[model samples]
Target: MGAATGSATPRIVIAGGGLAGLSLALALKRALADGIDVTMCDPALKRDPHGDKRSYAIAAAARRMLTALGVWDRVAERAQPILDMVITDSRLQDPVRPTFLTFAGEVDGNEPFAHMVTAGDLTAVLLEACRTAGVDLRPEGVKGFSIQGSRTDVTLTDGAVLPAALLVAADGGRSRLREQAGIGWISWPYRQSGIVATIAHERDHEGRAVEHFLPSGPFAILPLKAVLQADGTLQHRCSIVWTERAENVPTLLESHPEDLLVELERRFGLQLGKLAFETKPQAFPLSFGVARSFVAERLALLGDAAHVIHPIAGQGLNLGLHDAAALAEIITDVMRLGLDPGAADVLDGYERARRTDITAMGVVTDGLNRLFSNDVLPVRLIRDLGLGLVDRMPGLKRFFIREAAGLTRQEAPRLLRGETL
Candidate 1:
């Protein structure tokens, strides 16, 4: 198969409709010529907000990317900007939760370093934008695909075949397509599991996020906006990601609600006042996996499909958004230059642009998780001192804040800089 002739637009098929796939479709629609065709496929109709009771920390660059794609206004309505990030290291029962380090949580012009966004809200906005952009939204999974010279034939779960110049696998970390393509990945299974839930509190979070480094893992309390309760009153709410040893996650998940609340309160601290469950608790196994390569013949990987890293830094979604923006940029450039979208050169460029950042983040998150997820005295002392020192250095603090905010300012996609891709 080759490029379709007779006025048929160049087709690009993106599998998986999560943040990466949806954002890529929107970005491409905005950047590529109107003659280009984009189709996004997922097994489900929509990613329901209530399905996952977790929120994401969207960095400034990723937020700008959303703005460029025209989805942030809707997202901002429910989004909670993180004004500060406080870090502490202590046991769950420690009498004092001393602040070892803090980040101002702002970039230039006082822009928030990140915002806490629910997966549902983000997906809803992106899905609407894709629809408005004339994207072909398919509610079918990609069962399998075969790549031939200059084209890819994709078979849907319903046995429908769709041909496209390029096929992208954004099917998440355990990407079946990636495996089907025989792409090998290095996997490191952490003995930890992340327990995600939403909580109603008696006090406001004041736009601050907290990360408490416990022996088992890092417990992050991300801020969220007040939600209306059934009693006709607004209640303060927050999303909590409690990382515990893999062995203990079962007990934590099986505990009674009241009993679970007690344990939550201990790790969550009284800073937020009394807490109650706003959503059912869920646990997910944590692991680090990065694909050996991000591209194969006529196929490419994005987001969790490319790399799944530790969540210690909460950059998983941010990294995925970056991928979307970058890939869209590369593909748009390829079309503008009259190059095949799925050409080896094009895919190689995309992979080269993304691999370094993804690998760096994997290493950073893995290192940070390892450094803090234990109670070794010497390691603890060294890390605590390092944190304190960084906290004391204003320039270093700003650098870290900007870096964490994804403001590297080098080869970042135009969308990430609030420009058209």
Candidate 2:
């Protein structure tokens, strides 16, 4: 890419400095360096310090992306690799419950199911990455934007206006910039809220991830590794994502913590010993959402602004980060070819490349949510049989596992390969 003389850096304005937004900025700046000007606008200088503790099941590919961006070393300690995964059905009263497929991380290659890390840790590393990469991370909220012929003009809440050849919206599910760009989205409530909290258990997790399908929704217990307490006793940290129906939020949050832990223990079984209580309960509504289009004029959508899905599969953040990777590649190619980075023609290429994957994941996750969250006898039998069938077919089982881990046919972003830009 040519650095066309004085004061001519292809400008990019990123909105929302959360995991997705900050990551996009860091990745772009690292990839483009001074060839382009990167500015990230986020008002929240400090993260939600007292916020509900939650973790992300970032795929192996996402870890690669972070490594390339120079953020993984800081985040590695906070994450535990998922060495195994189990999907099953049935309860204690019944002895002959169906056994679903079990996937081992090392089945196909030296790949793991996913790495579990808290949201707080993810943000910290990304912020550091931005600082080191010299990304102009502006801490101001976005208010509105206008489409200029060759650029997009963004108005921040603090009465500052900036012009950029490209505008990327990582502002999350309810994106104000996406709306101001006249980008319509397709969204609906899923009648469920994901209740996220950390729990300390008596038994060691042994780097295992478990997802149980209950009547309410999928309950995911992700491992956070064993810690030695001050008394020298082993305590395991795990993030529990309890997707409950919206109507049951109040009752569940207000319910006794001990009783809730007991119920969770019963549902999870004895693989891990007795589960203990930790942290107050929290809840969030679950919804399967996606945007209608990804590109418009000089503006583009990335991360949550592009799509959202049921956390049952734990690929929400992975998908968002993947989008960031693809978009950066496309834009970099355009710059290399001596074309406008935000050209509509180039943006169309990006949209075309990602649309299929985004739509496919949306359908797959939504379908899985419906399939597992129901109690129909026929549905149960079919899924159980299907699960067992996949288990027997090692090839198909490994294929599905690899796909979930974001190790697939697509050309990996440099980060996934652990290469620094």
Candidate 3:
């Protein structure tokens, strides 16, 4: 159940089976010395089809991680590359959505800035890769755990006990393991809700993504693969992340289908042609949260467990994927040197590498949500002008694009660089 210090193959128990946990398992399985054991626990993994029917904007860095993990082949066919992006600022009733910024989405001649991938597709592929890599997938949640010298004993919800050289808490924003470890966090509920769903459009999106900043929040139109409708005809489809005031979201969610479409059309515009719901809409309350520390003894937090930011930039998942690669790289490097994977200094290295990036992203997303989610004329004018100025400066625009693509940092993990661990 556990590895002896500095000798036996180390055992790593990850307490979540979402993208973060699975990716971590796969990364470790590929990087660690042979015989190392990786186990992931989450009841949801038992579901035949995982995910809530939403799409994610996968940054270039994340795509590289998927490629290095050898799962991108399965994900690539279904992925929709975002070849361009248009940013605008206007009210819902405005006759025009003025483009204040535009980006040519390719980072290099070969790579696009990002791709739109359904959550289900990505998770299924990652899970299969984890299985192929020999990760022990447990269909039980982690109830809690206790850290002893050189070993951590985990308690599963089914009352089973397991031991590992290191315990990872990837259980998400409301991580029970994190709370049990007494990790403090900073959190604030935004008075907004992100309404998500897929819609069929009359015209092709041609791989362009759009973000319209409104008084309530940002409405993002992300491209998705065409799907066969009930009539057996292939229809163009797109994903929508429509943010509205928190108080107004409930009413919107409860509104009649016809009425909801009217409101949607108000913000969505007719740029992509007529739109109809391809899937029922869902709403998630928006919030900003960051754990005070990313590591605790034999445990480390990943993904939403460590930080949760506004959906304005769609960088949440990418950040967690980065954490998985970084942590895996750090642990495997030390282990290759005959050092303990759970050594305090090894964990400290992971924290030092990720904390700054996480904090910077949190600040950027929070500032964007505040600056653009208001109706004040002066503020709007200033931000719009700033956006326009950035758009005009090719060098500055490219810099921002590279940052969003997750390539600006020089000390990133191997997977982020499209290299194997």
Cα misplacement distance, residue 36 of candidate 1 (Å): 1.4
Better of 1 and 2 by lDDT: 1
Residue runs of model 3 more than 4 Å from their true location after superposition: 1-7, 228-232
Residue-wise C-alpha lDDT for candidate 3, range 219-253, written one tens digit per residue: 99999988767999879999999999999988888
Candidate number of the best lDDT: 3
lDDT of 1 by residue, 127-220 (tens): 8888888899988999999976667999998899988888999999999999999999999899999999888899999999999999999999
Model 3 residue 83 lDDT score? 91
For model 1 the local lDDT of residue 139 reads: 88
**Which 10 consecutive positions of candidate 3 have the poorest summed lDDT?**
1-10
How far is 263's C-alpha from truth in model 2 (Å)? 3.4
- Give every collision pair in model 1: none
Q: How close to the true structure is residue 137 of candidate 3, measured as C-alpha lDDT?
A: 93
Model 2: CA > 4 A from native: 1-7, 48-52, 91-98, 411-421
Arranged by lDDT, best first: 3, 1, 2
Query: Over the stretch 1-421, how does candidate 2's per-residue lDDT look in tens digits?
Result: 2222235778889888878778778877877788888888888745552252677888988888887777788888767988888776653345444558788865346757688888877887778778888888777888878887677888988899898888889889988878877888887788999887778877778888777776678777789856677999878888888777799788766778776766666656666666665677677787877888898887889988889888888888988887888877777767766678887777888798778888989899899989888778898889888888999998898799889878774666655556554
True-structure lDDT of candidate 1: 0.89
